[model samples]
Target: MVFWVPILSYAAVILLTAVAVLRAPAPRPPHLAANALLRYLNLFPVGLMGLWGALGHIVFPARSAAAIGWATSPFQTEVGAANLGIGLAGVVAAFYPNWGFRAGVAVVTAGFLGGAAITHVVEIAETGNLAAGNAGPILYTDVLTPLLLLILLALTYRSARGPAA
Candidate 1:
């Protein structure tokens, strides 16, 4: 349940948007799809999931740590704070809709999630921790979300730029 929430939400938003766009018309604008993807991707997966992580770590630290196969520590609070920052930034990026600002948000989100994915891998290797939160969908999302965001960002930039000169 814990590991699935973000994945499900992320997939739900993307799938829904894709369906809507596909069903729209024959000559859909390319940039519209890219822009919508960027907005929802940031809003749901990055923003809401970050907030959810903050809630789990800050409000339910013991459970969060247990799920990750770790002892509760003050560091969880720091992690929660970082989640809060990322969440806020993601939410703002969705609303602001500027390429440069969205790029910065994507970079920061990638940094945080990419770092978390690396730490999760190290923890799994060092301690053989296979807890759901440590070695499940959470880890995959941590790694893949950033990559997807970058890809979408590139597509959006290209579409916005128009034809080659």
Candidate 2:
């Protein structure tokens, strides 16, 4: 139960975002009505998760520091920048449903996931433990979350654009 809670919660966020994005009322209007509502409802939770993960990295230094290589370490700085960029992308995607917005989300999502994957590899090399205790949470937040978001983004893009484009 303890280990499963975060996984379930993250899944719920992704599921809800997918539902909202798929069901969004036709994107027609002054761009300030239902579209705004849909965007916020879909993207806000994911953004908050990213923001929370970033804050956790700072506030729970003992736990998160090792995963990123310490708060001030170069690796940590890169992770922080990636997280911030992804968080902002989520916010922007909430308000814009264009191809550009989708591309930004995809790019940020890849950056975040790639950074986490690299960090995990580095940790494994340094410590000889794949499941470094402190690293699990970071993997859940950075790797799993972005992967889920990327899937959601792809689904949304496919549904919105159809098969041709």
Considering every candidate listed, which one attains the maximal TM-score? 1
Expressed as tens digits, the lDDT of each residue in 17-121 for candidate 1 is 788688878788867777888888888889889899999999999999999899999999999999999989889988898888889999999999999999999
Please give the distance, in angstroms, between residue 94's alpha carbon in candidate 1 and its true position after superposition.
Answer: 1.8
Residue 85: error of model 1 in Å?
1.0
In model 2, pairs of residues that clash are none
> Number of clashes in model 1?
0
**Deviating ranges (above 4 Å) for candidate 2:** 1-9, 14-46, 58-63, 66-78, 130-137, 162-165
Instruction: Show how many residue pairs clash in every candidate, following the order shown.
Output: 0, 0
Every model's TM-score: 0.90, 0.57
- Global local distance difference test of model 2: 0.55
How displaced is residue 134 in candidate 2, in Å?
Answer: 5.0
lDDT of candidate 2 over 42-97, digit per residue (tens): 36434655555556544554455544444344455555555566667676776677
The 10 consecutive residues of candidate 1 with the worst lDDT sum are: 156-165
TM-score computed on alpha carbons, candidate 1: 0.90
